[model samples]
Target: MMSFNATLRLAACLSGALFVNAACADQLDDIKKAGKIRIAVAMGTPLFSYLDEKLQPIGSDVETAALLAKDLGVQFEMVSVTNAARIPTLQANKADIVVADLSITPEREKVIDFSRPYAALTIIVAAPKGTVVKDYADLNGKKVGLTRATVNDTMTTQLAKGAEIQRYEDDATLITSVVTGQVDAFSSTPSNLGEVMKRAPQKNWERKFDQKDFLLGIALNKEQPRLKAWINTWVEAKLKDGTLGAIYKKYHGRDLPANVVQL
Candidate 1:
């Protein structure tokens, strides 16, 4: 027969185990139980998420999402989105997080929560091969295409106050309009320009302008402090281990921003 002392010991062990399980389970639980985290990103190539020639999703953001999921101990699900709609998507519950090339502006921060700035980006004007669009001055009285509802669209208008502005829902359409002679030139983010150049290297588009934007950020529900805190910490850890720099090289083929070391 078992002694009474042994029975008490067994019960205490079980109680402690239950408390440990409860304590160890929080954000980690929400992710696993849901099976996937909705990650928002643009569906393109080179810098952000994109399909390779073989149709595999390959980009710095995609890779980063995969690694983040691994670190969080959950599966990752990507939600293809546009620069204009990313915030609404998160706010509307269409996506759980925004991992796109989202710039953290004070205006944007008023509506959404953001992770620590990841990278600094710039906006530029790119023209097709042999076109005369050179700089902002050249764009005067010219027709320029930009992505609708993007920061670039507004900046383009301000820079080319006298120029005709054409707006599209996304980068692909805007670039297409420029490619097919529908517009004189296209103005967009440099990371996106890099993707366009990779897709059509023979076009030999020259960047006539550059607008240095503040750091990029990841978006989450404003109330999700736990998840937001975790992402912020995760980004810091990646920076610590050189993973951020390595990821940048894998996609952009170079080092990070001058301020990355400080990040």
Candidate 2:
């Protein structure tokens, strides 16, 4: 009993509803169809993703993401961004996910979403071999150099505000400052500081700290709830399967401490 005009209006309404459904899309499906899971990782050595002798990328984060892509049924693609640009990169849709060592902070929570953290990396103090900075007590008034964008600055300053805190642009510079006697010690996460120690111009230079701080998380935009859920679920599965611990040991050369908690 509908007239021609009524039929046309009904068809248009149905098409509009379809368009609305399409607009509120599922990014996971899009990624799978593209056949690759892209990642935004901070550039560095031995800690996150890094370049190897063969000029191929290799590291804990890199290998872990590749495995995650395999589990997700897609190829892995990595893009480098800095700490400052990390959130912006995700917000701008420059990367599908962020696997860098993103510390979960309440301030950051307002704009970005984070996956359940699978790893904990807090800052500690590094001293050259034979330097007696074995604990917080030994750092009363020493000079400490810390890399920016890490938990180091606050940790160092809080433990001993009497001590001088100098922030650097990168890990290499902070380590160099400690090595060259420009600073009494350096501070950064275990992975970064450990990597610097491993490649120190001399052997046996290392850090000492009694307490750890925060766990790192995979940051995403507020809209990517599905991606956040996927990473959290995937990380939990890896931990249960022992693949998570195995991969960390393979790169870090030790087991994760039992006391270290994941979120």
**Model 2 compared with the native: what TM-score?**
0.77
Counting only residues 3 or more apart in sequence or on different chains, how many pairs clash (N, Cα, C under 3 Å) in candidate 2?
Answer: 0
- Relative to the true structure, how large is the alpha-carbon lDDT of every model? 0.73, 0.70
Model 2: runs farther than 4 Å from truth? 1-24, 129-142, 157-160, 201-204, 259-263
Candidate 2 lDDT (Cα, 0 to 1) = 0.70
Instruction: Give candidate 2's root-mean-square deviation (CA, Å).
Output: 8.4
lDDT of 2 by residue, 170-241 (tens): 565665666566887777767766666666657566757645667777776665444555787888888777
- What C-alpha root-mean-square deviation, in Å, does candidate 1 show against the real structure? 9.7
Reference-based lDDT, residue 86, model 1: 83
Candidate with the greatest TM-score versus the true structure: 1
Error in Å for residue 6 of model 1:
46
